[model samples]
Target chain A: MIKAEGLTKRFDDNLAVDGLTLNVERGEVFAFLGPNGAGKTTTVRLLAALIAPTDGRAWVNGYQIGEDNINVRRSVGILTEAPGLYERLDAVQNLTLFAKLCEVDDVAGQVEKYLRLLGLWERRAEPVGGFSKGMKQKLAIARALLHEPPLLFLDEPTAALDPEAARTVRDFIGEIKEAGRTIFLCTHNLDEADRLADRIGVIKQKLIQVDSPANLRHSLYGRRVVIHLASVTEPVRTAVSSLPFVEEMQQMDNALVISLDNPEEQNPILVERIVAAGGAIQFVNELRHSLEDIYFALIEEEDRETQA
Target chain B: MNGAKIGAIVEKEIADARKNRMIILSMALIPTLLVAMVLGTTFVMLNVESVDEASLDEDELSMIPAELSGLNPSHALLILLNDQFMFYFLLIPMMLPVYIAAYSIIGEKETKSLEPLLATPVSTSELLVAKSLAATIPAVVLTWLSFIVLIIGGYLIMPEPVFLAMIRPVWIVSMVLLSPLLALLSVFSGVIISSRMNDPRAAQQVTGIFVVPIIALSLVVLAGKIFLSVWMVFLAATIALAVDCVVLYFAVKLFQRETILTRWT
Candidate 1:
């Protein structure tokens, strides 16, 4: 779990994170989304106690970030943007060293456990310098999880990996979440966030919006339902648009996309009218707003507010 | 301050150094080569032309230190040259540590390995102390090893009494006391400089320049301007220990976790 109140970090004249307050509950996957230079990495560093917040306070895993930093560091795992591994050291040696530093009991067993879990056990003896970027990143994740900390702070967890490797990392994150560990993942990948995050926080030097993926999309653009018909007949269009619950409707190809004032209360009446009007309905489904749309809209709104 | 964490870091460095060809070569070969070159070249110079005991002039006799004045010209020259070479031994403690400690921290940064290590439960003091110990221990060991080799080699070529006298209280005190203190100073200075600079080469170059005065002191001893006796060795060790304390204090002060993670690179 993570809690921050008015957490601000300033480097001389530049404000990296400004008066940002947030809470991530236990066993929740909270994805932090922002563009470059948007204070995402800085916020992660502050929460991890790698750097102290200039003003305000934060608690990670129930320990105050600045005051109980040692305990806080011990309780959380961090995967930096760069894997930051000892390239000259092999995977097993790397994990073993971290395990000892963390004072993990049975360090060898812990190292082997994480290395095998991350699929680096086969290459344990090979120097990490020879590993592919994806392999190195996976090894880094393994290093973070070696001590099995309750909380994880991942910065750009899949930044430079190929699509397949990225998917593997995403699946691993999902697995971590399913295991009931708190994750504060900062990433530029909105689609991955959409799929894996229980809640996503869109940030720009401050917290812009924080909500579940479905709730954010619904708040940005009200529920949209699409009726796929055999043909875009005038009868279907007029019948659907004339309904009391229909706020707006647009015809795209043979589908009629309608935004309703309240789809839950009014969808049955709309569907009955389409059937009674002799319109051949192929399928009907509610259209959900993509995370990409909400991401751009939120970021653009923040930029516009800044300019004003 | 946890010893286990510090031990883990030092152990990791040793493992890394074993795998690093440059570090292994510098640690093992440089000291060997330096001792061989200094002693071999000295042996050839002293044994080039043996001189009669009575033929030496008083001016040349007076040039030798008072401790070795009673010996024959050849014996006296061997002792004087051996003593002059003691300064070169100082170079081992002073120079080798600069290279090791300079590379240790900045090399980690360049490789992008410092962030995660710092992110661990190890405190800054623990990290810096482990690093200093890692650089200092091997350098001190090599210094002692080279001194042993030099002593054995000197005994083989030079007169036994003269060689025996050279390894007296002064040399023993210098090797045991002054050498480690000087190595500590070099390592701590290197850690400080390496932490502030982004490039390892630049850090090493600067540390090399800062250690020039210690090297210059060795040159002064070689020139017979500064006579190094057991008492003088103790004095030098005392002064170096004081300086080491000061350098360590400032190193700890300058070594900020936030600045290192954000400002350097």
Candidate 2:
């Protein structure tokens, strides 16, 4: 639903977003990961047509950014980092205001639907100034979704909230993802992205990497299986290393950490070799890598490569 | 432009103004100060004896319009003072809307609402016009209502002849026609200044200078330097309309989505 080519934004001499080319498919939850000043918000603005890209172009929902700006804006929903609620206005009034501007046919129906879905129906009468940050953010999400646009761009929705409030927003995003809208989520919370994103794009003023969380781990570190054995025998290591299918092996205490090209296909052969060589078998499982581990490694590696 | 979207924004601004203490205080202060100034002068004109030709010079006295020249010298001065004070009504619409208009765009920056609002399909023209109308409606309405009170209060106190001076075509055109134009000019100017500025106080302080030209004109009238004929009123109205267009254009140009999104620090 969203596509960009060489999308760059330069604020005078300082480059905010540098040559970002990307594609987010329909119904895909694409997470954009970056640190502060990583051009994340600038990229969102460019894609949403809030600001024109300095050198490149993008299309959102078949409408080209900048050229077809109003249509592009009409086609997508963006939940800005700040909730941006009219604090003096009541929750219902706030949603109603955007609903009118968005030209929604059933303003009240859509307002009530999202408010109830986000668990904000009870407090709809209260002034938004009195709402908790989490409540205000949910109301903002509801405001963005009032017209039920097909694509969504959420820029740091859970940035400043406490863990509980952040979790609420994450779950709220989870529910939004399930609703079948293509979401382009920008988040500093790696865990939230890891859980919610169908694919992830890492950037530091440049498009560094884009892949699913699992694929990123696999590409960065080839598949490895950890075999737990009751006792470490010298022959067990020699036998596991002798297997022609084993790509690499390391012995850690009583476990054999073995690299495999196809663990499902090749693991039985390696296990057989270890058992035949007089090693008592325990169990076997694939080694899992956290997104944080992969993220830092990928970022550091990319940063080092760039510097080199 | 979408009338529904503009109407919604205007409606929202008015509702917020009603709830805002700053706007409410301004609403009360403007009309009260105006009524007090108008009534106080009307009372003075009621009691003063006619000025003899020997006291004030012919050149100074000649500034009164020929229509009022036949009245007592004091009545002529009353005509001048009342006309000059009509200039103050122009100041009312011009002055009242600036504060709110200054706040309209800049306040959006403060609350960080501009992005989301702009994220919608509302065009720049629609947003600027909505903001201008939001500040303009209340200000023009206040000036009109306060004009009514000035007319009624002056009628009760001043002589029939001087009271008649207050309702002449020049003052009527100045109030009903010119003042709304000046109000829009004030609002457009406010929106223009606010779009470039980071501080609402500074924007308002800068926009408050709009009163200076009106005040200068008022002083010139009071100094027996000029009399506003019907032609002059139309001329001034035309100029004010032109200036409003120019300022509105600059406001639209300066209020770029890129500048606003980047510079709203």
Please, what are the lDDT tens digits per residue for candidate 2 over residues B38-84? 78976876667657767887786667666667787887877788777
Q: How well does each candidate superpose onto the true structure, as a TM-score?
A: 0.96, 0.94
Among these predictions, the greatest lDDT belongs to: 2
What are the per-residue Cα lDDT tens digits for candidate 1 across A1-308?
78899999999999999999999999999999988998999998898889999999998889999999999999999999999888788998899889988779989898888888888889999999999988999999999998899999999999999998998888899899999999999988888898889999999999999999999988999899999988888887788878867889999998889998678888888889998888888998999888999999999999999999
DockQ for all candidate structures vs. native: 0.86, 0.77
lDDT of 1 at A95: 90
Candidate 1 local lDDT, residue A179: 96
lDDT of residue A193 for candidate 2? 91
Predicted candidate 2 versus true structure: per-residue lDDT over A148-186, tens digit per residue:
999999999998888898899898888888889999999
* lDDT agreement with native, every candidate: 0.85, 0.87
